[model samples]
Target: MEKNQSLVEENEKLSRGLSEAAGQTAQMLERIILTEQANEKMNAKLEELRKHAACKVDLQKLVETLEDQELKENVEVIRNLQQVITQLSDETVACMAAAIDTAVEPEAQVEISPGSSRSSDAFTTQHALRQAQMSKELVELNKALALKEALAKKMTQNDSQLQPIEFQYQDNIKNLELEVINLQKEKEELVLELQTTKKDVNQAKLSERRRKRLQELEGQIADLKKKLNEQSKLLKLKESTEHTVSKLNQEIRVMKNQRVQLMRQMKEDAERFRQWKQQKDKEVIQLKERDRKRQYELLKLERSFQKQSNVLRRKTEEAAAANKRLKDALQKQREVTEKRKETQSRGMEGTTARVKSWLGNEIEVMVSTEEAKRHLNDLLEDRKILAQDVAQLKEKVESGENPPPKLRRRTFSLAELRGQVSESEDSITKQIESLETEMELRSAQIADLQQKLLDAESEDRPKHRWENIATILEAKCALKYLIGELVSSKIQVSKLESSLKQNKASCADMQKMLFEERNHFAEIETELQAELVRVEQQHQEKVLYLLSQLQQSQMAEKQLEESVSEKEQQLLSILKCQDEELEKMQEVCEQNQQLLRENKIMKQKLNLLQVASRQKSHLPKDTLLSPDSSFEYIPPKPKPSRFKEKFLEQSMDIEDIKYCSEYSVNEPEDSDGDGGDGDDEEWKPTKLVKVSKKNIQ
Candidate 1:
């Protein structure tokens, strides 16, 4: 039983050892994985460092190709120092990694044997030492990386500083190149000037008169230059004023066009008024002609009526004379009859039959006389009615109303009335001749009857006497009635003659008035013609004056243009002279730079030789010249003063020209103050003139 218990305890001890060995091996494998991860991280860091080292080498090569010798040498020194530092850091890191690998390989081999605890303890201690060494190496590598980063920062700072210096150097080189080109131009100009001087010297030596002439020409040239400057100033002022002047011209043209339109309108209105007046006058003349013709027709009618009344009056006078004669004869017969009756009373019974026959004859005579009296009365009534009609017609004609239809029909032209009056006179004459023939026959019968009655009275005087006495009384009554009608007709004729005289007077007055009106119209026409002629003359004069003024203004504008052109030419010449002066200045700057370079070179050489002599101790100090004595300071020539004087003169001339222009522009306004009346009253010219004056000022 004791042998079996001892065997069980040995088996328990073997199992415990195996479990411990397995746990230790698992721990070692975990540590190895951790170490491999650390190694991969270190390798990535080294590759980054190698890439940075390669960029630094490229920078060194770029710096070696620099144009500046001093900067290139400095960059080379910094680049070599950085490369040596990087190589030392890389070698140290590689050695540390190799020692860590050698130490870890033995720790891994010893860990595989699970029976030896002392060997495992020794492996742990060695691994600890290797980890400590690796830690120290990592610290050193980190310090080296920090140093490299600081160097890169310093190098970048240096490169940043040098970039601006290089840009400045390039700028200075370009400036020098430009200066050299300008210097060449100046050299050419100087050669031309020298040639000209030589010519002038030769001409001066040839004749004293020529030298005096050259001086005179120089003085003239100076004067011309002054004039040119003044002209240029004036041209500038003129250019500024041209816009205003052109605007004024446009306004003037517009105003002139308006004026022309207004004049045309006025002329049209005048012509229309004249035509209307002429038309009205023609109408008035036509009316007057119509009135004159009417009056003439009325006068003709009156004349015809007067002629008819005169003929009627003559007929009445003739009738009255015949009646008077008949009455006288009748009275004589009645006396004779009474005497016969007295003689017959003594023998009353002797002749009774003879007295009855005589009474019958006397009764026939009384009936004839009564019939003639009735005819005369009818004629008188006709004359009275005709007279009344004539009076009414005269009244209507005088009152200027239309005549009655009867009068209108009776009215005739002058020629027709004259012919009618002649025809009526001829008819009246024929009637009077017939009446006289009948009266002669009746008178003869009366004579024969008187003879018969004397014979019968002797036989029976008492019987016939009473009947003859009664017949004589009746005849006397008839004769008295005819005489009254004749007197009335004579009075009416006289009234008609008076009215005709008054009508004649009125016609004469009307004719005189017509003549006077014609004279007045003629006088008015003459006056209108005279006024029209005068107005036309005034308009012509005004137009001519305006044309002349326009011509003068145009001429002035042409002169201004010519002056402007001349000024422009002078300005071009002045600009060319300024360019030449700029070239001369550039040449002077180039000379200054060359002299400074020579002085610096001489100083450097003197310092070097002095240092060499001191080292050799053989060369004498007296042989080399002193720095200050070797280089003589020669000052550059001063710039010409004429250009500055010309600039100042040009400025002064511009001011003077401005003042002159102002004065000239204002002068016209002062002069124009007087002629404000007459045609100058036109608004366009005055306003334009004023505007021009204001703009110029």
Candidate 2:
């Protein structure tokens, strides 16, 4: 490179001398020509030409002195430039060698670090400065590098050695032109391939669009199916509610019928009690009337006998008193019978049987007192045994020695079910918080993207101008028909620039949207986390409640089992006692009926005795009075009757049936209702009562 610069310097000096010498020689020749012909025509200009020739020769000699300091500084500046050029040339050679080595070595060895890139940038700057200087030198060399001056110098120094580089440069230029041609052909081939790839992409887009349409249809179908399922579930629940209502109504109707039957039984019992009382009054009255009539007849017979024995007055004085007693008894009998009739008119017949029948069921219910005591004793003994066992069980359970809870392993274990919901809620809450943070980040990203888009738009507006101008120049040059191919190249370049600008814009927009979306997702996650936390808290609360309920349920189950056991024992005892009492009641009722029959037979005998007594009373003395006469007229008053008793028995039997039906039907039903879900079950007493009353009424 230094040699090139020196050669350039030497050539500049030679050109200056040659220019001076030529000027001097031209002036000298002009002077000679003037002296030869135009002496008479160039009278004043002739001397001036001679003077110009003399000055030109002096300038020529001065131009030849190239070894001066001014020239040396110029040389030194050139030398510095030469050194820079030499350094640059050597670096280029080194870079080339390195590149060759990089290609030969593996890919791992030739990495460009940031620092290396910076160094290369500095090198590029130095190269750029040298290139500018070189460009100026090329212009100077082309104008001043004269072969004629070298020829003249060769003539002066006949024995000097010299070689020029002109032929070598001409050969280099031809080779460069050939390389450019090959590169252009390759670029054309690449353009053709790019066009083919674009066609393939267009075809793929059509297929993808078809696939997306199919996916949309499937999604719509799934959504419709889900809606149908929801509707079906709703319909099922509605039907169940209707069924429940119908069952409730039926139960209420049955209860109403039982209530009516009980009321009728109570009315019948009251009627029977009244009738028994009336019958008892009537029977007592009839017995008293019969007794009185019999007493009167006895008195009459005694009086008749006394009359017959009047002749023998001293024989029976006591018979006269007896006759008076019988007459008094006859009057009392009539009074008693009338009183009995009046009492019968007010009250009804015999009611003892009715009262007994109704109360028989009540009293016959003998509590199983002995059995209860026995069972209680057994239970107490068992409790004592259980207490001892409990201590041992407690010890085992304390050390986790009890059998595991009666549960199988499930995704939702009772323990995990108790707490997993809360954990998930907490996790979700944390996620929500993270999402919130992400949302903020997305907002920042969106702002950044927006800024990037603005920047891109600003840069693009001016960039297109350069491309457009280049296109116009190219188009003007080509459309002139001088070079149509050049216009296409220019158009391709312009299109590439537009596409790059559009891609940059799209990239900036996409980046902004993606960043915003990411942040939004973060916010959503944070919100979800918060929701999860809330859900977890709710779940924890529910778990705690459920655990308490489970504990309560366990305790209740224990109580229920104990109660059920007790109930079973009591029920068996009570059933046995009730059966015994029922048998005893039936015996007592049969005995009472037999006694009523006896009373009727006794009344018939009393009636026969009354007729005989009336015969004696017919012959009674004028004024007979005694304490025995009062006793004779006493009659049975109206009172209870067997017919009333029978009616009462029938009523009681009906009432027992009613009571059993009402209790039996209601007990199990109420228990089931109690076991129903607490949320949905409702005993609509008002509705039921109204319906029941309506049916009963």
Candidate 3:
């Protein structure tokens, strides 16, 4: 029992040790698991950041492409504008030459003389028409110039608008820079964390010795269990033997008790006989001794009586002395009480006098109760009057009568009035200030509205000019056959200049848009770069986390390997035990085979005896020896059934089953001997030989 308990304790201790190791391993595994989760999260974030960066890069490229296209358009527009300007300049020069020629022709016509009357009339009229046309063209040119000036003003306003957008972009860039700085700081922090995690991972590495130790411990435990099992089996056998021995011991004890009882009875009989013989002799001696003891006891009693009388005398004398001392003490106590009584009586008399004197002293108050009562009465009377006044006021309010007006107006002195005027002036000043502020706001609003109106007007002016151009085209087409070509040329020059101005304005707007877009793209790039840095830091942290997890997994793997080795050891022990059991089973099988052969021979002899009995009983011997009757009388044999044979044939190879089939057929023939032993043996062997031959064939 002690050994079993000790083994159990050892097992418990080993289990505890194993659990501790498992706990440590589990803790490491959990740490790894947590780190892996963190790594996964970081990976996801990194992927998101990468995706976002990719999207931003794509957008930036698209913006750049757009800007390039806009730049090309602007360049085209500028080129067209320049070409138009040049064309206009050329047309202007031609118009000036035409005007000079017309002026010179008129003078030449006047110089030619009035003798050619028809030529004079035609020249004068044509000259007047040309001058009128020139004047009209000049007016149109002035209008065009004014329109150009307005366009220039609009362009300036557009430039001013672009300035604010540029400022906004600059501010955005500044903010993005600040954000990038913050991201850099964060990245630095993350890097530090990653480094720390990496250090933790490095520090957490499991040593090879620990795993080896665990495996050794597991092997020892398995060995202990096997030993304990063997010991327990031996103990069981010992206990069985001990139990039989204890039974024999109990029977022996019963016989020993009977013998002991007989011996005790004999010893008791001898002791009784001896005690009676000694009692007669002791009685005679005791009588002699009794006489002498009675004499001595009488003397002793007389001496004790004298000693008691002496002690009583001594006690009486001591009691008298004590009584005398007590009497003196009582007298002294009486004397002390009398003196105390006199002093106490004197103190009581003095206390009574002091109490009387204190009672005789009276206190005087300054005010009389009657005066206080009178004051209280006066307050009560006043309260009554106020109550009456309130009642009257309430009644008047209920009757809807207006209360008497409080005349707050007073005749003002010059100083007071001056103060009042100053206050009014201050209020007026404040009002003026507010009005001025409102006017400023209104002016700003009006200016904005005016700018918008100008922009709208500028935008509409081109449509108006185009309409005018259309009108001019119609009019020119109507007069094309009649009008001089100079006027038409002037009109075309104006149209070209208008188109050039329009293109220039459009180019300016496109340039501004491209600038804004570029600024925006730059900000986006900075933001994306910051995000990428953050993602990289996160990725680094994740890598560190993964390393930690890998360390933890390695630790777990070592633990698992130890467990697997332990399991293998356990399996090996089980296999050894199974092998021993198989050996035992094989021995039992050999014995069973011997028993079976004896039973078979006995069965054959019984069959012969039954046949002889049947013949003596006048029954047919064939009937007793028939297969059906034999099967009925005999016990079942250990032969393989048809199903089992078929199953074995299907499961094994054909060659293996061929030999097995011979044995199987012989088992049935042996169980039901169809003839004598020799005949049966010969017949079965022949059949087996034929089957074997067929299998070989």
Candidate 4:
């Protein structure tokens, strides 16, 4: 019952835990959804900000245009606009950071929980970890939201600040537009004035000074054009030369590549040859070693043969001494038999014959030993010849030539010679052993003969001593021959060493010459390169100088053009002022002529009145009553004066003047039937005369 209660309790705890986990998961999902929504809102706001930024960019482009037009006064406005853009960008960055933080936090919190929940303990641990992560993420999200709100407030503040600037910028734009319009109007007026001046200048005859200036300007323009053509030709030539140089350089590069490939091929061939040579050298060395071993073996054999020959010579000397002792002993016995035969005649005869036969046998044994010595000397000569043949064969093999049939035959002969030598050596050893054994037996016999002849051989001992001296002389001659051979070999070695040293010296000289040639070639190359560089620099300098000259000529041309335009404008203004002064003078001359004409009319009227008064006094009152007695007075014609003629000519030359005739008032002629003298008194002459003015075209 107790176990069952415990199990029920555990089951209830597990259920409670699962309920808490489900609630946590639900809250997490809600937070995730909220974060996603916030991200969406932030993205939309960012898009709106991007649109505003694009508008600002357009404004920036306008400011840049103004700058290009040299509107320095608007620098401050451009700076303010740039500052606003920077502030907005900074705000957008901050908002984006906040949005990213908010969006990433929930995902990070969810990821914090382990994927697998294999046991209750693991599930509980995962839940706890998730809960902790969620709390941290919530705090981070709240901070991000606060940051975002603060950024929004800053943006609003910046927008408020930017509003007045935008208004001012618009106002500045309007003012600039007005200034541009005024400038355009002024430009139009100047253009019109220039056109009128140009027309006048073209229509009027140019003064001598102006004509000269125009001719000079044309000449200068022609010269400039010619220079430009020349420069262009030179540039074309330079371009062609540069193209040819490039082609040459390309060819040189190709040649260098070919050379490099050739050098590589040569190096590969040299390496292959060197490898082949090394293999051949190794074979030669092996052959030399084999020859050296064979020679060493031959030397050992020769040494052994020489020792055996010495031993045989000693044995031969010992046998000669034994024979000499036996000869002495027999001579003494012969002397005794002769004395005994003289005393006992016929019985001693047989004994004397036996003694003579024994002496003949000893001489035959000495002849056999001399024959054996001659055979051994013959064998030694044959061995030396074989050795020489082997040396020649080895030389042929080391010379790196294919062996001919003769050489192959010689190699076979050498093997045969080797076999023959070994066989002869064995035979010689057997012969030496037999001679040693024979010498021992002869020594024993010599000892017995020496005992027998001890009393009788003192006289023959000098001859035996002379024979030993001859043997010693022969051994000394052999030693001298060997010493002579050694001296000759030493001379040959010294000659070889000298030749090798000379070869080395010659090789060193050749190498030095090669090094010097390489250095000379390198120096020549360096000098050529330096010369090429100097030429290039000179060419570049010439090009630069020509360009500068061309630029200066262009500037001079512009200056001359400006000066000519200014001079033309000055000349035009002078002409206009002169024309106005001439018109004024013409008006003054016309006024003077009208005043003179009026003066002439007044004088004529005065003369006529004076004449009428004189006639009235001369006639009687009674005669004046008659009509037939009245006289008519005529006015004289006015003659043209020189000054008037001159003035009229001048006015005619200047402009055409038209004259109109005015009505002349003539004094009333006396009536034919007039009865009243009082009628003449009542008709007074009118004084007012109308003068017409001439119109000058």
Q: Pick the candidate with the highest lDDT.
A: 4
- Over 305-383, each residue of candidate 3 has an lDDT whose tens digit, in order, gives 3554354344334433433333343344345434434544444444343322222210001012222233334333433
lDDT per model vs. reference:
0.49, 0.43, 0.46, 0.52
User: CA lDDT of 85 in candidate 3?
Assistant: 50
Superposed model 3: Cα runs more than 4 Å off? 1-431, 434-516, 519-561, 564-697
Q: Model 1 over residues 1-697: C-alpha lDDT tens digits?
A: 6886456445434433433443343344335435645854775575467557553566566695798988888777777766766786678566655544454343433333333233222333333333333333333333343343334434444555565755665565556556555655555554455446544656546545544544565565556555555555654554454554455456545543553454344345435544755665676566445546655654676686566556655555544554544454455456545655665543333233234334433443454355345435545454455555545545554564532121222223334334544553454344345445444543444444444334433545446545543444434543444466468779999899999889999988999999999999999999999999999999999999999999999988998988898898899889889989888676645544443454345446544544443343333435333454332343432233432343234333344334434543443344335433341222111111111222121
Summing lDDT over every window of 10 consecutive residues in candidate 2, give the lowest-scoring window. 682-691
Candidate 1 TM-score over all chains jointly: 0.24
Cα RMSD of all models vs. native, in order, equals 59.1, 87.7, 69.7, 36.5
Span of ten consecutive residues with least summed lDDT in model 3: 359-368
True lDDT of residue 626, candidate 1:
42
Model 4, CA-based lDDT = 0.52
Clash count for each candidate, listed in order shown = 0, 49, 0, 0
- TM-score (C-alpha) between model 2 and the true structure: 0.13
Candidate 2 CA-lDDT value: 0.43
Candidate 1: the clashing residue pairs are: none
TM-score of each: 0.24, 0.13, 0.12, 0.24
Q: Give per-residue CA lDDT, model 4, range 39-149, as digits (tens).
A: 658756755664564435545556556645556446546657667656766786676566555654544544533443332334344444545444444445444444544
